[model samples]
Target chain A: MMDRMAVTTTTRVAELHELLARHETSPAAGNVPVHPELVELFPRGLRTGAVYSLHGSMSAALALLAGPSAAGSWCAVVGVPDLGIEAAADWGVWLDRIALIPRVPAGEWTSVVAALVEVSALVVAAPPEHISPGEVSRLLARLRTSGSTLVVLGNWPRAVATLTGQVTRWDGLYDGHGHLRGGSLRLEVTERQRTRYADLELPVRP
Target chain B: MISAAPIRVLLLWCPGWPVLAARLVQGIAADRALALTDRGVVVACSPAAQAEGVAVGLRVRQAQHRCPDLVVLPHDVAAETRAFEPVLRAIEEKIPDVHVVRPGLAAVKARGAGRFYGSEEAAAHALLTHLQRFTADELRLPVDLRMAVADGLFTAEHAAYSSSARQPLVVVPTGRSRDFLAGLPVSVACDRRLANLLQRMGIRTLGDLAKLPRAQVNSRFGAPGLRAHQLASGEDSPILRPRVVPPELGLHVAFDPPAAQIEQIVLRCEPAAEGFVQLLTRSALICTEIRVTVQLEPDALFERLWRHPWQFGKTEVLDRIRWQLEDLATEAVTTDDETLGASVLSVQVLPESVDNAEHHAQGLWGDRPDEKVEHALTTLQHRLGHESVLTSTVAGGRLLHERRVLRPWGDALPTLRERRLEQPWPGTVPGPSPATVFSSASQVQVLSADGAPITVDERGTVNERPTWLRTHEGQRRIEQWAGPWPIRQRWWRKVKQLNRFQLVDNHLTAWLLLSDGAVWFTEARYD
Candidate 1:
């Protein structure tokens, strides 16, 4: 029997490219101009305007949204607004093109979140003071429909818990002297959800 | 034969965190987990525990009945996450990129970090030692966490969970990731739905899951299943995201405050201007115009612009701004004016141009010459305020209203007429009526004193019915008259609506005008 999981991913990647091809207006050949950060997370660029909540280090997000191409790409970080904005600016992201939506009380934020999803490529939203299974599913659907990626910044969404693909674990270790060993650390990213692919660990040396 | 790279994972699951802590208290590296509660320590005695013959949800009495020697302790979520940060920080100080997949689990790239710390196995040990230190500090507890470096993230996660003190890190060879996951359970592969789906398909092991048709699995499981498929086959490498540089011209200077007098302010700007000029010199660029901000205590912050001067010189630039500050003091009768006492916190310089050859040629010679033209404008704007020093340029338009553009000393963009006019602009209702407008515009109602309807015919004529109009500022009666000017615009626009109105006046010197649901107040007399 053919490996079901491996075949699904290959076909999915092809289907996505076909959809993106339908939206291309410019005559640029080969690959479309995509934000590099999205490329790292999802090798293919995410859809233009949607909500994605990436729950990880500030540096991780910074690595993606730091260039002229990012300006036209709008993102709103919900919980850590100041840190997110400052880091975005540090990464060459323009302030004029970006909008910062403040953090709201628990459980009340989702009502207004759908509004922002229309114009932004990525939105960082936490479950309002409380998170519901419906809200998580709805958020995922909204992101998928809008061609956006959602990064739930804290715990993984309990509703749609099945994980697929590689999950990278990050860690920072201090040297004997304690000075930051710049760009010198360890990284462990493993394949958690897949069909044809074997579960593997990706290690970064420098 | 080339060997493949391995994924480095830090697994921290030891059942209940407290049970693990209790084990450490007994001078053993605890593998059992526990939690602290309001009443006392509570061990997470559940099915997974009871499967091993431990009791489910009971007091210490009942739990001990099931397994008297069972490891027990308190629960603490905060301690786990907190104690976890230092271990991460310690690893992060050495790694280029690190991610905490869960409170206890971490994913690190092994190739780079392993080389820095030596071999892959050695790097794993160093991390374990560091984490042991962190865990030891938190509960004075001994911990036996494990590390697994494989080709993919899933295998590493599984390996970490399965590893014991006897065999910590299972370093799988490159291209062997697929083989390693063959025997792993599919339950560990996903959350609930896919896990159930895989179980339904009778595919419990990763190898069994990989055997099914991919297209069918993807269509059935949706996005999450598609991802699961990719991982089982050992695809999707985690690429590290790097930072990009920002482009902006910023200059900042902090000063000791409470400095009074224009002379003192002028003196303060000298160094700032000099510093800005020095920066421009180093970059081989000349700033055409500069914006100066004056910090006024107890009230407001004042901002102005300086025009681009022809000559470029450091001395000239600083001297001109100094002169502008000094002139402001003398221009006012009393030096105690609101504008006089403000001290400048810092000055910013925008490099408006780098096209000048003289600047580049001078830079080639290692000489940082200052710009005299920018210096002159800086002073002029400082003394007269930015708005006072304006430049005018002709703009293309059929109407006199749109004929010209005005700019302050340092502001860069051209003046625009329409609100967000870049796209299909909204044109105002048309009429060739007034030569000038001033004061305010108000709305009015036309009527006869006896309440009989006063009619105004088309073509700007009023019948002898004693018609009246009202001013918006107040509901005063009409006192004067002007011809009715009817106009239409956007005839080409679809679904067009009428926006026509007549000009009338209310009682008193105040004049009122009405059009298209809006009223305006204009002055009666022309200069």
Candidate 2:
């Protein structure tokens, strides 16, 4: 199944490259780059002015931002105080440009997010419990106008894409004697805009 | 062979400037007698006080006795300098390079400006004219302003001092400075003791002093005498080097209909921001301090100074503008509308301090991964908030939580620690650190094999080794365990002590447990 997904993604990427060549413009003109492992999940690359919802694995979501962040784009993580900085650094998320606002007041969350979007290219946030659909829509509008991408950690109504990760197997530990060196996770990405789905198993390193 | 002649210098002098500055701030009438006193001595007195017999170096009581109605104000150096800032700005508008000698005095190289303004005389006249107009129109004070041009700073200052209010300017002809100083008193060359010595030697005037043999004067007066002889002979001192004036690059934007919304104002400022950054890049200069001015409707103005830890680019500029506008909008709503008013008529960005960009540019040999990260982090901080992004640093302490410190980005790392890390922390848990530290320790129950609750004694001893752990997740058998170390802190004052134990569960999850003689609390988890 993984091989089939890879073949289908390669064909889609080839078609995209042809279209891009005909247009005579760079593919990165209006897109944010993603990790090579996530190429099968987002064959055309992540859109610059859109939102994606990632569930289950925080490390996987952070890995998705490594490429763009390392390429000189600023990223912010909001409302996640317990986020392990060591884990983030291990996944190649440049800690220098990664802003972490552990918590924000519910009433000021929208404005804070808007402010962050004005300066940062990518903002990963967990929406507060009291946020309404109207507020989210307004934030999305601002994000679109500013050409910033939003990566939501939980369910975001009408998200452009949704990604979920499930750990398949844990390795490097025998009867708790050895350290937990790494693991394997099955990442399932579903695109709401194209009604397409892709799944791939990737290594998870802590 | 002959070297080039010395450059001409121009001096602008404002006599009794400290008294004038103090009176200006206090709104005292010009005709009133005012004396600035420092530590019971009169440092400076106004013209009115001088007329009544008050003078500098006089005791405050003596001045008061001389002039009964004298207003004695304490001398404030900062106020004098602050009042002089406007005068410097006015002079800089016409002249590119001007050096402030002190609060009441300023000097500039006259050769370039003289040629530009037709002659040395014309330059002095033009500067005096501009200053007189500025004092009359802007300052609205009748001040005694004087200007003079000559071959050196000392002669120029002397000429400015000798000029009367009617003329207010004196220009000594080029290459004739020695002749101009020939008739001046010997006291102008040195202190009273040297003047007395010169007088005793029949040298009553500067020309007489200049006529003495150089070696004879040097042998008698040492370096001070030689310097005085050089000055009297109209030779310029090598210490007075002219300062280089940097180019001023400022960007301004005026709204046609005036903008009130923060977003609209930010959008309008985009072009100016881009232009400002481009200009700085072209000049190879990086601005570290930015002065932003916001003009409001009907004469209300908002101004603020912003500083950057590193060089500021277009994104940082735009972010600061938005933040300032948002703050102003809030003020308008909370305060009276008449004070803050509505709408922004114009916005100006002026770089207050700049440095050569080449000095701070990244190297070409190695990859600067840290630089890229810092750039991104600062941009995010500009947008979100300064305190939102933080970096963790290890501090010296006995406890794990106390040793960890989180500081905002761009702040200097703390160097001082509460306790030395090299010292042995007797009660601290040894080995690898925990993966997760709970904000608050969770309560747990540890029981012996006989189904009795395990506890610690005041003597720092545990009841049993074999145990079952009951946590929020449910009961589990202990696989391996070590430690019942006791820590006594503030025992004399608060009387607090804790016994720490390291235990592993059946699931192989290690836990650091703390007991205060009663209950067990899970402090951290090693995953």
- The candidate that wins on DockQ is 2
What tens digits encode model 2's per-residue C-alpha lDDT throughout B206-309?
A: 99888888898999999878877887888866344444444569889999898776777888899999999977766667787888999998788789877765
The CA lDDT of each predicted structure is: 0.46, 0.73
Top candidate by lDDT: 2
- True-contact fraction per candidate equals 0.00, 0.05
lDDT of 1 by residue, B1-527 (tens): 11133344333333344444334334443333222332432345433346555543466655555665555555555565655665566556555456666556667777776788778788878877776676678546555677787665666776676777777666766677678788887876678777887888788887887777779878988877766766777654454232111135434444566555555655666676677665554443456665555554555555556554332455555644554555544554664653454555544444445343333332321221122323433444454454543333334432222332344544443535432334442333222112122213233455566644444444334444334544344444443344333333322223123233323233112221333322222322110
- Which candidate gets the maximum TM-score versus the true structure? 2
- lDDT per residue (tens digit) for residues A1-206 in model 2: 33453455446546655654474433225777776667776776778778888887665666776767766667777886655444455456676566667767788788777767765667888888777888988898888777678888888886888877655544443432343344455667777445444443323332
